[model samples]
Target: MFQLSLATVSHGAVASIPLILVAPFALLLLLIATMPLTPPRVKHLWEHYYPHIAIGLGLVVAAYYLWRVEGGGTVIGHTAHEYFSFISLIGALYVVAGGIHIKVKGESTPVVNVAFLAVGAVLANFIGTTGASMVMIRPWIRLNKIRISAFHIVFFIFVVSNVGGALTPIGDPPLFLGYLRGVPFFWLLDHVIGQWIVTLVALLVAFYVFDRRSFARMPVRLRHESEAPDTWRFDGMMNVLFLGVIIAAVFLPDYWFLREIVMLGAAVASYRLTPKDVHLENHFSFGPIKEVAFLFIGIFATMMPALNYLEQHGHEFGFERAPAYYFASGGLSAVLDNAPTYVNFLKLAEVSASTGGGGESTPAAEHAAVHQLLADRPELVIAVSLGAVFFGAMTYIGNGPNFMVKSIAESAGVRVPSFFGYIGRYSLPILLPILAVCGWIFLH
Candidate 1:
């Protein structure tokens, strides 16, 4: 069944990392997942000191790599570069999207809400889940302000911020990493579009059920107020140019951080030029992005050891079936940064495919292995790709846009579930089964 021998793959300096180094990442995730459930004073302390906690944990890992491991500085440097690129794109999108305000004056019936989410889902493929979430979330809240609840925010993350972006490289970061690694631009659209539609439809239907209940619970007068005819006014239309610049900047050469520079420049231009009234209407602030930025520093840094461990040992899990890869990659993607998780699993799939005799230990060989896997076992590739993008909605930390959407919703006085509450209430009970059925039907 195996095509290539695992011995052909190189572990490099990452092989020397001890399992103990994973503690920092684990600790950080635990804190993030549970802190909000703590007592009021404790939760307040966590909010006040989260930046220091996150950065301190990140520094610990950085110091370990700098002082202890061989060739580790290079790994840390690459991670830093990745982190900078990540935050730059996210921050730029946040700033640019924040400048454009969409005022929705209309009814927020279940059908309208579903259509809105469907549109956001489609928009996610073009502008990215982060961009789509930033641009669409406030409007969503305003549309549903009469009866918004935690489920509204959770379902928004499900449809718009994560699963909606499975169709294109621009839709999600993990897919872009696949594109960079030689997957065809339309590979996902070709292979997984059916499953994408199925999953999206399932989530949307589930959302409609919840929303119908929510709509019914509203008093008759409030329901009438929410169901009134719809009108939308656009403000800060000039920011669209800045958004286009940011999106175009994604394709710029990575040399000297040109992409990040262009993105940030556009963001600064948008922030400075946009009217104060638009910002006021949008209730834009730096708080949500600031929270995402500092926390992700810890997440990206501490996750290196976990990712490294997976890279060095992933094949031993004996994942011979597409379903195994689906759940394994999806399970990890739910917690770790799914971009690197997707890449590592892609490598594992490549290694698994090389057992039939075409294995080598070079960068070119690795690239070729990806094509080989694509040509030979495309199902595995689809499974991994879907797992990474789809399961990213399973938790607040699962995707960059998830937390940002939550923060934005909370800032607007919408009720949002706590981190664990998000999983226990919506992810496990609602989202997981839909994803699982999709995986079984498609990948199994």
Candidate 2:
């Protein structure tokens, strides 16, 4: 069943996929990254036409695979299944979270802001970055609305949406995929807890510095007014139960689409049960999720050849050390969807281990190879896991939640950095250094 769901690219199909097939994926990414930065007329056209463009490009790849590749039907079927699961989980979390409105009175201080993000980081592990982001982003914006800046949104993506989820498979999609592949639930917590702490601390401290400066820049009267104690009220508390349903549904076996069925059912129930006023107060709309669904359809479809190419040739890249795996996986994760990137690197690590006299790399030997890699080369697994989750913050397209968060913030009238701005102004200059130190100190 797993093989059917995640069909490996056969050796014969490797040479058949022309390198030019990757062009659509690259073109799509270029448009996603640069379209927003374009002039208003162009950007407006993009807003209107992006769905068509995305779907059309995806069809190009889908057509190629169906016509040319062996077992292409199985591969496309796997991609479709993956897309359904991905959208179901994300859509369910979005709906359930949208039902719950967290109302905060008064403004936030840098200390309070730091604490809020810290708690958000922790909550990410339980309900997922998507769930936590949907639940907490509104309150976070309201808490600091008096002085909210792009940095606030960017840091939230950095800490809450990405790095914080490293502790458990429930925390990040890549880690969750690892769990599905037989990695123990607690393996990450046991191995990378220390590094997680250090990385979070570094990010929190950096956030504090930015937040403190933002706080201080406020007028004296507004600063004093912002210091008032914050009060909170949660409406639509019933959605919490539905949230638990969605999370629990994640553990259900994938056969017959049981997992997705449960998730979508819970989302429907939550949406129907929640009060209309609560949705109004939360300013919840389907626009954000709709955008994600459309763009990611293209991403999933277009990225198949890229992922397959990597799966085929990954071992050709001499990744002999943990740091090498860390940076390589991370660099790719910054662009590609991190989940498949994690899986491919894990396969590469398995191939590396087998070639180094660990075991055979045949299809029947694959399951044993995972266990062998875990027992003998756990560090490589750690690198792949950390790279996929952490570096997902590097771009809006890197993770599902990042774009949603940005869209939500923008809807709330908060200024968000453009895609390149996110990478240049924050991700590269700030987040990357901290992640680099972590890779150096730990994975190295």
User: Cα miss at 153, model 1 (Å)?
Assistant: 3.3
Candidate 1 stretches greater than 4 Å from native: 1-17, 176-185, 212-228, 335-376, 403-425
Error of 1 at 287 (Å): 2.4
Question: lDDT tens digits, residues 348-393, model 1?
Answer: 7775655643233344554576788899999999989999999999
lDDT of 1 at 7: 25
Clashes in predicted model 2: 0
Q: Candidate 2: global Cα-lDDT?
A: 0.83
lDDT of 2 by residue, 287-320 (tens): 8788878987998798787666554555676787
The whole-model lDDT of each prediction reads: 0.81, 0.83
Per-residue lDDT value at 12 in model 1: 39
